[model samples]
Target: MIDSFETDEDIVVVTEFVDKQLYALINSEGPMPEELVRQITCDLVSALFYLHSNRVLHRDLKPQNILIDALGKAKLCDFGFARHMGRGTMLLTSIKGTPLYMAPELIKESPYDHNADLWSLGCIVYELLVGVPPFKTSNFASQDCISFLQGLLQKDPRERLTWPDLIYHPFLKGDVLVQQDLAASLPPLTEPLSDSQQLFKETQRQILLDRQPRGSKLTKFVDYFKQKISLEEGNVKTVDGEPMQISPSTTPTPDNPANSNSQRVHTSKSREKKKSKSFEPKSQTEESESDEENQVQNYEWLDYLHRSMEEVFNHDLSCVFKPPLVKVATSPLLKRNFSPQVYNSVACLLILPFITEDRNSTRLKTLLESYAESNVVDLLVQGMWTLLAKKKSELDEFDLVKSKQLSSERLLAIENIILLLSYLVYKQPYPKVDIFLNQFCNAVKSRGSSFALVTRHLLTLSKRRPKIVSDILSIYNHIIRILPSQSLVVLEAVIGNSATKAKEKKQIDLGKFLDSPNAMLRLNTCVLIRYLTRKFGASPYKYWDDSIKQKLVRNAKEDTDLKANVAAGLAVEVIKKLELITSA
Candidate 1:
């Protein structure tokens, strides 16, 4: 031991000199004999025990930090990262130590303490046995050694071996007491092949390699798509040996306006031709010719577009539902201020285009534009409730100024949501409509009336606006159709627990829409009524007066829109049947 002082610019200390580092021995000799490792373990544990007894933490404990002198004794150095814990302190959250040897808790940026040093010591021990740290993924085949290492390398600090427990482990049962001095009993050190820093870097590299998931084997894009198309089309070939079929493209319907009409027509004609000839016997020339045509080269760009859409669909868009808690305008008709969560969700969406490579591809750009349109509608539907939270926070202080901006965010949000609900009820978005509905319904169920709140709010606002009646009724029609039983629950919530029949009757009056001039609104109202009667039988009839039933009968025969007439006709039948049953 020696006294030392710090200079103006640096801290310096004097200490007894050492002949070589322990890294020199491990680097050159590979694995030492069993007796020598046991002795080293005993010495290091004793040093750690003394350090812990004084409340000192040697945060960095690696082979490079331990020096061996002329007497062959191991010395723990590197006080740079050491800290003295106060008597009552529990854990340290600051990260310290080398990457290859840091404890899992430290790597995760979690709270940890003295046990971290023990993990580093375990790494050093593993390195001594296999010439590399255990995290580097080598198969060191000794079960006993592995078990001992597992005790120290536990990811959970609470379960890791502490000094008190390590002393009695099977590997160190009777070897806790250092029997002889290292000078007389340990193996001799050889010339070092590499410095400690270089070895540590190599260890770091190996650990990274071990922790990462292996990438899947690459497939040729052309070949893969070719095989996919072949399997999908039943390998139908044309007379000239061409691929005769591709994925059936959709036509622009009233529901999906972006669809391709010509492509759909071509696919329909192809299917009809195949069906008409399947039963007829073929001549010799006809038997020799194949029935399909190859168009893979022409549709390669389409395949790329499909891949991009799949990527967007698979992304976790649910983050939009987790809006930050910020005050929004209470009234459903007014514009609401933007919240931090909205910006975060917008950022998440903007990053989608860059998720796949070839950001410059025109097909990807078009696909993202299309996705953004539909996704905006979905985002409004799924997250509208979050924007409706009535909070009297700081934003309320500037109410007059904010109100004048006339932000139509909430109204637009409501409009798009109802439109989407109507589309889902009628058109059913192509490719995976059922899957989308299943997931959407599950999310709604878990949220517990979040969507219902938005729907009910729109219904209330429609009382004054009048233009949104069709939209609100369409939403109810969708809910009752898709979620028959859940719709009853949501409807009960919407109507609320009215103490008087007048209040309940005023909550939702189906007869008002039946007499409206708007045909779509009347149609949607009829559909809503029909579904309610079918599900609840005569229970909804109690809420309606004789005029409501009379209006239903009038619309059944005289409505201008045929679809509205059909819907009214159906509702009249349901009401009559349910009323008859009630009378019975």
Candidate 2:
């Protein structure tokens, strides 16, 4: 391999890529028959012994470096930092080498000799026979390169093992003669130390060519050191810093309008491109429109209702008895166009639920009685249909639908509705609150739009009224049947959030839905179960029987989504929790 090089720095090396490291091969294939390991160790010790005898110290040695060549012989290649020891000199003061394989003295930054390399050889031999390193720490406590070398290569020097002592040790004495013979056959080391000056110069030239501006001489010095220690290719560029590459093929001929067929072909191509650009995915548009329609309708109605209440209270407080602002200008509804009076009626219909709150029951009842007597309730129902018509017209204009700001507005509106419902439930009696709750649920279910937001509101109500948890779960069950996968993510978030609330009076029974064939739903359910168990100590498995646990384990094992990992983790946690509870 060394013979192909034009220069020492240009030497090329090659090795086979094996499927597994030596340690892994030994463990899984069951130890290369102890005798083979002994022979291999002997060959390796011979190589190290010869290299040291010739004043070459290989500071790094590990099983990974002991490559089995085409003939199944060990060949060591990496020697970017190998050093020489001559005459009586047995120490060198360079801090280098791999951490795990370095001797303790070297780790301590003490000057060391060929014996340091012998210690690393010991580590490799032990690993070969036992499938693990001898001095290796479980948590890698003593593996820091410098610290480990210091201990192995101890400053006292006497503590370090010599080649003769190591070869005869019980751990390495099994086949000594063959090892010594191999060690004795390596060529004598005698080449004068070639200054790495040429390598450094070539590296500097490459760096400058690559357009890498030399920030300081210190950076160049660091680059010089790196080049000397490794054979990695330097980033090179042209002297003028121009990007270098092979040129592209010739351009195509321009269209000739004089040729009528050519003109027609060009026009057709342009039209086709235009048509492709015009086509947008239908689902993306529909989802956006649905979100926007929800926002515009909810905001228009809620804002109107809130203003109507303020006007009513202002008139009552001032004793003005001003005629109620019965009508106002209105925009188109989600699916249809409606007049101002119809819009007011729609707003009034939604506000009726607010009137039945605990603090305002009497006033709300009186107001309802007056509206019934005056036919206001009927007019409001009519207005709702008109608002629906207006919404239909506006829907066409929302081309780039599902704006983030609109979704946020919808969330806020839903949160407000929940707050209003909570006030009603807290202050009103059961019959009245139940009546209003039915009205709220009807409005949500009727819209049949943005069911995720609706589910979230239902979830909040369920927390306050434990009986309502069943109702919300039923609605969620219906939602998962009709909603797309993306929409389901929203519902899952709401369900998971509610399941974790400490204030929830009833446990959310996710058992029925957890096994849904939909992978996303199953994943989401597992996520919720994991979160609940971790955060609230709610073991869904307890609520679910052993059959459910077995089913869950099977599903988790077979599920293809990344959620299987999460499920597996959760399974471990659940098992741990069960063990703890059972022991107690």
Candidate 3:
């Protein structure tokens, strides 16, 4: 027995090399003469009979496994999973066959004999006759194969036909039987007919022609078939059973200019007809209605886009300029106090280009230049500082004012604006960086409670532009000097924030505040110094000086409230920083 590996799961019995399979030949060239299908089916049945007589059950019989030699003789192969049955014993096990052609008994996992093979044969014959399988259903489990078996093959095994009886089944008993006899008596099945087929044959010929290597015999065969078909007269029938007419005036002839010209004209007309058939046009009234619907949808989308753009801009501006409480309280009289609406409008103006398609890049650049000239950065910075101061005053008098009027919302808005602007600056180099920095420095110096907000903005800026560290350090130094003793905690927070950078650690000198009379000042100074040491590999002793450390230790032991708490926290931070620095 010849053997060949078929797939990862099984092997196939090797047979004589065949040019093609009978199923593929029929499928590609359309339904063959019924006689040809019968002849092929007879050969398949004979092979199945022989295999069964030898005690081998072809459990997985399918069209692909049935090989057709060049002589048109069918052979059964691929018996990798075939089971052997001793005399008088039937093989009945798990269901295994192609789903569409499987026997009802097999699908139900019932004990079955060779009758299952006959059921599959009926399915194949039905497919050849109808160009599709019988009993097509979406629900595989619901398909009652028993009904098909009973009607097509007779339910009882004894009643079902043997191989001899199947060949004479009513469906295959007419003109097909005569044609089968003729095919069987003829010489070997020649290479499939080329001229008397559909356009698919011509396409296949062309593909095969192209795939052949240079100077191959297949090229000669392709040319021979192409010439024969090109010269043949039309005989095929249309679906309506009328003869398809080929106009002699438009017929293509080999190597004739007149024929070529006429052929092109005929092709062009055929294409025009096809185009007209596919083309569709709505009535004027219908078109007008569609246009109106589209216009409404477009307007809705535009409106939503505008609102989203406005929201993004407003959020960003709030970070730059949060309104002050004093200004909020006196707004009724002055009517000039900044509000969320005003900030939103200003932000929209800044980012309007992103939302508007009609606005050109040059026009946007001009708009940005105009805003830069008006010192918009300074206005935004001042607004943020004013808003922070108002929030602090309101917090101090929380009982006097209703909770709804709290400035946290305004503070958050201003923070958003600062972040937005910071992002814009990083993405694109704004020509007015100096103006923005000067205004930001002034704001940081004036509002002590706004240090956290200012520090965060500076942190973002530092990440974007490391070269601006000196400028940021200058602003930090100025803020530390002017901030009140009570606000030293804010200063300490800002200093601790700056300690994120290894280089910025040296810029802050916390030891200078060690001698301050305010216990909070000394406590914050120790905290900040310890943080810098840990973050930047700086020595805690160097940052606080030995005397300052002693003072902080003494304060932790004496003062019980804020001062002691701050000192104790600083002590822990100092040891952690020391360990990190030493490890580094």
Candidate 4:
């Protein structure tokens, strides 16, 4: 689509005009044929691979950002949210994107990578196939495309489809040779090959080379769990009508599992075990080699399971219920693997919060302990919690007025932290419930407007996830059970929040509840004011409007409920105590 470039004024690069946006095309053209959608998905993903390989991330990926020419060819446009993200660099914390197309990792405010684009790709594919994004529409039906769609929509990016997996999957591989041939023929046309198309063909060529057997192959992995792989050991399979090196012995008879009997190859340790029952002492070198082999096998097995989660079982809600799935989320030992750890740890935390049953909780806890040997739990908690603290501090320094107009990264970060904390408090409280709450309250103290926005965020969450919020709210309300001891910590936070809001002079719509007719509203409002007095003592007299202060004081003093009266009286005592201390 590139026409020419003008770098003189603002480096404006011109491109051929595309008559329509992808969103409009989908709406006007009805649902596309599944096969056609598959080809589109391939081209789009191939484009993404090129962009990602070049160290760029198209942060905002939605149907609106995609353009369709009269020939129905798609071009990814809009680089406003695009940024160059080098290898091992921190995940883009400066979030900017449409919400519906965002990956769950981004939604949870976890550090994410290029695979985030795959998640959005999944959304686009779903929209094309169903005329709406997955789960958003009841109009779509489940058919041949469901499995391919599920993998891309996976919440865990580590478990989501990667470039290699996308190219090899059945959907894109419907006629593998044909698709590759089509991909290859693009370069010869009068049109200059797009960066995306060229890069995609290049990837396919590299993949084809890698897939070729070298000198009859030395090692054959037993894909024991998922034998549906097209490749088979020692099997003679026709590849586009040409015989391959694979022999009849290694051919898979997956459809006839009962009749499929073959010699099971044993791993080194198993092979060693077959030799003798007696324990034989070995040299240190032998022991180290055995250990190394076992480690390699373990990692390979984990990788296989990661693929199986996406390919075989499919990433459904049921995946979250499986206890053993924690291994996918557990952080690796090496520090350089922190990005995966952050993603996995966040997944684990999100999973834990939703487990309400005792049996499920115990099952999940045991699985987590088994996977990471219980070492990473506290570390994971501390790491994510710390990132959240840092995000809040960053939000504090950014201009609130301008920041408000941008994406809500800070809002998502805080809500995720609170929900994770709430879950931790409910599920695994290694930091101790009271201690963790204190840390959270303290985190909120310096957060400035971030704290003020939390009330609004929670209100929004309450609407969207009422059942989940109801449960989370109970854990939060439990802080009141420890009242006057560490209970005032939350109250202090509320004071800080109200103070920040007052200073900003921005009125949240929800904040209007004070003057509402609802008794519950009036009671909660009065309760907040009572706590404000306790924090300020007599200082509210100076800082607050006289009319407002008097109204709050009178409400607390004259409220009919005895509980309300007592809360109101505490403010007076705080004032008297401050006066006595001053007189001394």
The candidate maximizing lDDT is: 1
Question: How do all models score by TM-score?
Answer: 0.34, 0.27, 0.26, 0.34
How many collisions per candidate?
Answer: 7, 35, 13, 5
Query: Candidate 1: where are CA atoms >4 Å away?
Result: 1-379, 391-409, 424-433, 449-453, 463-467, 493-505
Better of 1 and 4 by lDDT: 1
Off by over 4 Å in 4: 1-76, 79-396, 399-417, 423-477, 485-488, 497-584
Ranking by lDDT: 1, 4, 3, 2
Q: What is the lDDT of residue 29 in candidate 4?
A: 84
Candidate 3 residue runs with Cα over 4 Å from true position = 1-14, 135-152, 155-158, 167-584
Instruction: Please report, in order, the local distance difference test score of every candidate based on alpha carbons.
Output: 0.51, 0.40, 0.42, 0.45
Candidate 4, 57-162: lDDT as tens digits = 7878999988877776777888767766432232443345789999887786554667788889989998888787768555343454677777888888758767
Q: What TM-score does candidate 3 reach? A: 0.26
- Deviation in Å, model 1, residue 139 alpha carbon: 99
RMSD in Å for all candidates: 28.0, 32.8, 34.4, 23.6
Looking at model 1, residue 565 earns an lDDT score of 71
